[model samples]
Target chain A: MNPFPASDYIVAAFFLFCIATTVGGAFVAILTARVIRSVCGLMICCVGLAGLYFFLNSPFLALMEILIYIGAVCVTIVFAVMLAEPDEPPSGQNHGPGVLWGVVALVVSAAICWGLSQLSLRGPWVAPAARVNDGSIKAIGVSLLTTYSMAFELISLVLLVAIVGALVIARTGRTKP
Target chain B: MSLPEPFRLLSFLVGVMAFVGFNAAYLVWVERKSAARFQRRPGPTEVGYAGLLQPIADGIKLLSKQLIVPPGADRILFMVAPLMVMIPAMISLVVLPFGGSLMARDINVGLLMMFAFGSINVMSIMLSGWSSRNKYAIISAARIVSQDVAYEIPMLLVVITLLMITGTMNLNEIVQQQEGWFWHWNLFRLNVNPLMPLTFLIFFTCMLAEINRAPFDMAEAESELVAGAFTEYAGMGFGVFFVAEYANIVVGCSFATVLFLGGWQSPFGLWSGVWWFLLKMYALVFTVIWVRWTFPRTQFYNLLNLSWQLLIPASLFTLILVAAMMKFL
Candidate 1:
């Protein structure tokens, strides 16, 4: 898989950088008090994830990740943050239930993380024996329009409904001026 | 002798940077001169011959000035925002097929990569505004976000139509499909889709809106928002934003040329090369400048309405029509 053996070090360095960015961004996203900064951190995480996808030989998915996540999703979140309160509620005010909820959240997250790690470590991670297609853009397009057409159409329909719902919700109570 | 791989890569990167820098500097001069002509005045005649050295003068001035951070502004984000704007525009340049052999990197998903980076431009503007901590800037940021979001759909729909027609997301391939005479261009491919011209118009309108040119210059509505999202930026910070804006115009026009007009294809069907691509791209850029001086800034809501109510529907119809045409005929 190493097309240029000499450049493997450079590739590895880039992979490390991506991993670091993803982890650092996730931490910043969770720990940051400013919602806007958190959104930026999420954007950083998405970019690193896109790089990882590129490493996985799926440049299409990688570009789509950046296109959809950092471009659309995170920007929309920042827009919402701009419209709404842009900061998290300050901590240290709540006493008991907040602490209890924190513990519950920590436990839940830990359990889920442990379970996922275990699953990944133990699961059958074999590659497919043969591929139906070369996984090119054309193949993706064909499969999308043929084999996955129903699912694709359904997803789009769902998105359309969600958009209409958002418009309806946002438009409520605005008087005709 | 051929250069080593690293040296070749470095040279390409340097060339791209220089290209982006030159365009950023001179497009401002072109815009100012064209804008002045539109208003019946001589523009920037002082610095050099017809102000040919104006951008250099402006660059030196910006470089010498102080970089001021507004008090209470988020310093890190504020400083990074300008870079954010510039870097994505620069990255998108790597994928632009300037000519048959004149691109830096010819990725298979070049079109998508260009667009993916284009989306980041909106995010950078949003960040710049939000970090400024100014009420006016925040308001402008909101407007920019919605404007971009609305316009991107129609633009992408138009692109999807082109993709379906060409069956490739490669920018070079898209251009190759439009090779030969002017009529073979996507803009005039009436036999494939009768609404090709209308589709081109939709794309052009969206490109204008996406790049925040007039009448879609809500991001910097100086009359209302006082330089809008970038009010807090000073000196080089402000200069970088403007350069990035011009660079984006270049990128957008180039994308429009590649997607619609016959990129690098000589209209006469004779000699063809990067010069034709440059000519077409600059022509579109001139149109953008012409538009800015011709039209007053549109009312913000009207801009959004123009996208949602007009361009989106029009582009979507073209998309479906093209799809049906391809499937049946």
Candidate 2:
């Protein structure tokens, strides 16, 4: 008799579901000819990823994944779609070159995925010897004020620059209008 | 009396599924009520006991609505986008600790994994915009990319600060460290230093931006963009996005609780920590909603500038001050 219960099967099944969702969504996002369809596929992929994050033990990240990506990012993109013309212009059939490009993109992405998967699956992972500290919010705070303070400071700077840059770029385009 | 491992895993999965479904429902009600209060309107009062049945009603309505696809749109992608937005929202709940023992797994690299999965949101949005074959969707998608890139940096920095202090990424462990009264909470009193308040404030601000709540909801500015990237979505497709958005709010509130409010730690030391944690999280969520309803939507350029100019610099300054304090004090 197997020591593991049937619940483990359930867990495994859920895991499989998440993986399938992610991979399938990604496939649809990239392979589908319709750009809008591709966007939907991407949303599916994100939802699957959020599931994976939940599995991975970071509920916070999972929520962030959904909130930031689905709530804000996806909605924004939808608005842009309504504003900008995204449909490909119709042209006479040119399957030969299109097929060639499609094949090229597929091969490149496949090779990358395969290589990364193999490296991760086969790579030697070092298990930490007796975790020194529980990475609690307190510890995170302590370190933020001490060790990684510089990085924290720099990130803010980058945000500042990005904000300014976005304003300038968007504004410059509008003056001529 | 030993439970088999498989049974335990099965129970966990069931529990998670229940949590996701229930939370999704609860959040919709919460958002409506919250939005209503903010707008000085009585929201969803007709359904079961002060609109408690509103979510069920909404769910039924959505379920019955025709799932329509626009002509000339990619039928397959149109069908799938909502699922893309939703599944991730559901999946990301695994690592959240409802209490000390309530967690799916205690992964060592929990922090990194969360970020890796989180980045996929951008790609998904971009795809939705592209597939929609609409000009507005394309612009919204471009804006999302720019906005995400801009805000993510400060958010990461804030997270990095937490990681550094904690010396580990396990969410449970992080909460465990903040035992005892409110002072023990990371936000209130950090080693008797006043500067800690600044850190907390910076973290919270960055979080608001990260979640894209106002004054940062430029992406879906209804007045300007007409529902933004989701303009093409209808019926259940729209429904999924709706649920996902509220789910994201829960996630952000939960993170604030975990990072600063002392996850599961009771503020008064009298009640169980879980209650306090929940209260803090909900309170934060309320604040997000409150801000959303209160502020006029920011211009897209101003939104970007807020991140790049204001938040980024302030965060950087706080980081340096913290480092200096650590070194000298």
Candidate 3:
């Protein structure tokens, strides 16, 4: 039998699952003193976000999320870990300042999360009248050439600059070593 | 569009679980075989003849292995990291269109949704590295973020070009527009010109960088990073990250197929769309593996320079040419 009827529930469950994973991971990432645990938490969060992408209807993004984030980003971070000493030195007497900083971070993050959720859930959204194009790959191609040509060109330029800038920055640090 | 709630929920649950399991197992097998051929060694040949049963054996071995948590490591966070890595990889599959009609949901803001979800991945890695209390893991995390910042912009620019051309963010519609034969595919020139082909090449190259295959895989260079962010992981924790990586490969291949290779559309009129789509995707995946083994890794700075100097400039030039062609010629 078709399980379509339960789709809403499934969606809700997955959504909650992703949120829990992300938030929980973030909590662990930030709260735990051990740097490795934080990295693990970050990975968990990304995985959840990937799930959210799937729900959002962009499998490509989901793949990119995992590949770029987990495969590339996480691995790169691990490399940095190996290169530098990043572990938090055990604190002996600075309890007050640490607690204050923790409180400040918690309050700020909570406020932002609450505000965004309220805006998203309560804000009025208008539906588009009639879909202009099917939004297919072909349609995207046509539009790139015809409508958004300037922006497309600009992105290419931006990429060029980023590549050059990254090279320059990374290169500058090398001569000293 | 309304339907009963229970069945839909059941189907979704089943679908997610099944796809996750399949993607995890199959991708491992694919990666092993791919790596084996690239290295000129027989990979997993003893297990089920050419390693067909290798994944099964691996699963059993990993499950049996003792999951050793380092004494200094944060217990909960360490346990959670691999799940963090894997969940995103599994979740991202929903939006991918295996066939035109086969998708989880066709959201209006699909593109933005993807980027937003994607940004969180770096945070997880940073956290894992910091939490591990291991020096190597911390360095790997920092490198991961830097590399992401370096490559993400170019990759995004490439996506924007595609979005501009199609005028819509929906993946299905994009594929539909390219229906017909191979020429109709966006990767090739429709009118026999050099610009479109060049665009396709640039996009393909960017895709490789985005996927972090060799030449771009500086983050995990075994000789340098010593297993990078995953140096501390073992058993299922490691397994989760491994599965996520393979899933990403599948995702990347699928995107290439859809964007350039006419996703699910028949190359010739005789066959159906799904078969052609799979062929194209597999071909791209194979190419990824081939390149990984064939080329030596690039220096990090050189890698960054390639994107900025070569890919960015070339893409920009092509953009101008495409605009000019569209306008007059």
Candidate 4:
């Protein structure tokens, strides 16, 4: 009587969709000539990455990825795009070294991508014997406070320094202009 | 045969869409009438009874008009902007509790989900501005992002302080924590923490800014900006943004109500249930409208200053104080 695929199949289909989004988004980001479109590509990649995070059983990380990256980072990139330039200027046609550099760059990137893929696909993979924790929000809170408290405080300190430095730099820029 | 799960979700989405459509239209009418009353002028009494049908007429007019995509606009991005604005506002409603077990989907990190979705509205707005390629739109968009980032810090701090007290991120659980007599509401958490009222005020101000409502609506200052980021958006593209704005307002109010106003908990024991929730939410929306008509918009620099200079430090103080009180008490 069932017309739709089972839940597992749906999950698998969605997983494939996420992978496609990630790969396609990366392609769009690099291949696009316009900087604004590239920014949009990054946003799409983040959204797909967030989907992958969701599938990994961490909704909080998924939401944070979207909230921070797409919401803050991408928007900042867009602002820079608007203020500076909308599109990358055309690279004038040059013959000898330009072709050489393009081929070399392509080869290096392809090799790196291939190596990473091979390493991931062929590496030793095994399921854990049993779960240690449910990985709920409360569990995360407790872990951060108890086990990872030092790292958390360090991050806060780092953020404080970054904010202060940004303010100083921005204020200086204001005075000169 | 349809999968029952998706079918249910589809129906829920349909219901929510209907609600959003009806609410947005009715709100504009409410706004017009309220503005009229303030100025002692009759408002839209022609369409149906007391201008009840005016929204439909406006909708028809908007739909009938030519959707002029501005010259040299980025075709795809320009069209997608309104969808970006509306979708998040729609998705956020899924986690909201209408009454007892009344939410479409009660995710664990419900409050965080709302904030995450709410943040996307600004991005959509920026995209709309840029795609149009208008100078005023670009300037308005610039103001929006800066204002958003400044106000968001205080908003998150206020939420952090609230979570510290309630000790959960689930909206339903938060409401349950504040259940009981009227005094037990988080707004009047006077006994537990005296700083809540101020937090509420700060949070509400940030909410007004976040939704780009008036006084804080620096992005849409009509006098200077020429309709701001939406200058080039015409027809239903513009209509979608308007609808999304009101939808966000409703969602923001519901979130506030759930957090601070004891959710659906009646002020008195006699008047209990979902009606109370509706009343409280509508009351907040009404206040937003009333404030819009009453006050002149703030200067952009002053708007940013209010968030950074005043609100951020105050919310930070409140957060620390609340934490200390939670520890000492």
What are the models' TM-scores? 0.94, 0.71, 0.70, 0.93
Tell me candidate 3's fraction of native contacts, as a decimal between 0 and 1.
0.14
Q: What clash pairs does model 1 have?
A: none
User: By TM-score, how accurate is candidate 1?
Assistant: 0.94
lDDT of 3 by residue, B38-116 (tens): 6788888888877799898988888888888888876676776676666555555556667766667566545544544
Evaluating just chain A, the predictions reach TM-scores of 0.84, 0.72, 0.67, 0.75
lDDT of 4 by residue, A46-81 (tens): 888989888777787888888898888998888777
Evaluate residue A36 in candidate 4 and report its C-alpha lDDT on the 0 to 100 scale.
78
> Model 4: number of clashes?
0
Q: Candidate 1: misplaced stretches above 4 Å?
A: A1-5, A86-93, A127-132, A146-154, A157-161, A171-177, B1-4
Query: Residue A122, candidate 3: how far off, in angstroms?
Result: 14
Q: lDDT of each structure?
A: 0.89, 0.71, 0.70, 0.87
Cα DockQ of the candidate 3 complex: 0.15
lDDT at residue B296 of model 3 (Cα atoms): 90
Model 4: pairs clashing at backbone N, Cα or C within 3 Å: none
At residue A37, what lDDT does model 3 achieve?
Answer: 59
lDDT of 2 at A148: 92
Interface RMSD of each: 3.4, 8.3, 8.4, 3.5
Docking class of 4: acceptable
